[model samples]
Target: MRNLLVLGLALLLAGPASATEAEAWQALREGRAVLLLRHATAPGTGDPANFQLGDCRTQRNLNQAGREQAQRWGQLLRRQGIEHPRLLSSRWCRAQDTASAMGLGAVEPAPVLDSFFVQPRQGAERTRQLIEQINAQPRGVPLVLVSHQVNITALTGIFPASGEGLVLALPLSQPARVLGRIAPP
Candidate 1:
């Protein structure tokens, strides 16, 4: 009986951390936060030397499992009450495909969301530009930005896995605060 009670107490203690994902989803659904999602698995690091922004064949596109993972993210968002988020994506094929696979509404290409992997010097400038853009936007609806891991890390200071999302409270006057992260379900 004592062991049972201890186990129950432990489970209770672990509840809040586990509940953060749900809470993050709720925050996003309410338009009180923004979601920055790293593009789903592309099965490779950075694009190939021959990569071209407009051609999926030339870029490291999403593999089969990655595609399914992206779809699952979409379903999770829908289940969490974010039916129509303002979706934005990097111009790269992988980012664009991930955003489209989310089944969210039309995705607008945001150049600032593009990967800075090749041009590391652009990271700081691009991060600043992205923050400015988000600050200028009216936060009346949920916003999801599908971008590369480098871009996401630059903005949030969290190196996210592919298909992972970081929920952030956007403060116009300062850097965004990361509320929580939601991994692919």
Candidate 2:
């Protein structure tokens, strides 16, 4: 099974940037994998100088297109058989907004999913904590984590685009087994 998963990852990495969402669905159907998603397109690059934890006004928020994109992602994910997934998000407004906007169930705040762009040093420890948590989670329904590019990259070594995601197999391997990428809706 591990070998087959590795082969899938190799094929996905070699394929086009247009990630096959079907591949992600197949991985998630096994019930032992999770999706790590980058928040939808927020206009600017990082947060503004006055970024705050719970204030959307103080952060780089999702544009109109991004909002629509999140809605479409919700529809698409539901269409793909992940109805009411256990969705988690970063405490940041943008990440939380993206997860909430998905309408994929309750959005739980996960501090480990917060971006480490400003404080690069915290990436490793936070990623470790996230991995520990994920590995410890009891498998059941589909799991989705809406996070920033920096945090997702730290976990899977893939710099995901806005709204893009990677399906990762669990137990927390050294280099994560990336089942496949789920492109933006």
Candidate 3:
């Protein structure tokens, strides 16, 4: 059974490594890579038991430090001259608020990008769907996903703290590969 599981995991990672990663500022300047970011720093870890999908007030939210980090990251992006890039977020409140604080304009909720903390039922399927979405996006305009640590880690094997971001190059017809990371600047 363990062998079978290991094989399965191996196959999962074998997907085409086609993304080109770059530093946050560099990616913004390049204007092409997709940004997979763990939501801005929150006070605690994962959402609380009472956390509700619809109400952010009920959840452990971004503290001043987290909010400031998000804002600074956004400013960095803007300074790089990327006025607008497609922004998507996990439905979690922390993720949503993180995107908002970045001053990046309206953020679309993507359930597929939700955290896999509680044993996400269809992890592989969800990741594949998100990858397809990223690939389908038009070239030149950056794609950004504000989500949770688990989600980002599961997808890229790169564990990130809140406010950390990964720039990925996903060219249509090619596979997506990890390029580089966007650490707090």
User: Best candidate per TM-score, number?
Assistant: 1
Tens digits of per-residue lDDT for model 1, 113-165: 99999999998898889989987888779999899988887777778998988
Distance from true location, Cα of 66 in model 2, Å:
0.7
Residue 4's C-alpha lDDT in candidate 1? 100
TM-scores for all candidates: the values are: 0.92, 0.86, 0.78
Considering lDDT, which of the candidate structures 1 and 2 is the better prediction for this target?
1
Worst 10 residues of 2 by lDDT: 15-24
- How well is each residue in 71-111 modelled by candidate 3, as lDDT tens digits? 98789778867668778899988888888888978899899
lDDT of each: 0.86, 0.84, 0.75
Top candidate, metric lDDT: 1
**Residue pairs that clash (backbone atoms under 3 angstroms), model 1:** none
What TM-score would candidate 3 get against the native? 0.78
Clash tally, candidates in order: 0, 0, 10
Q: Given candidate 2, what's the lDDT at residue 117?
A: 95
Global lDDT of model 2: 0.84
TM-score winner between 2 and 3, please give it: 2
Better of 1 and 3 by TM-score: 1
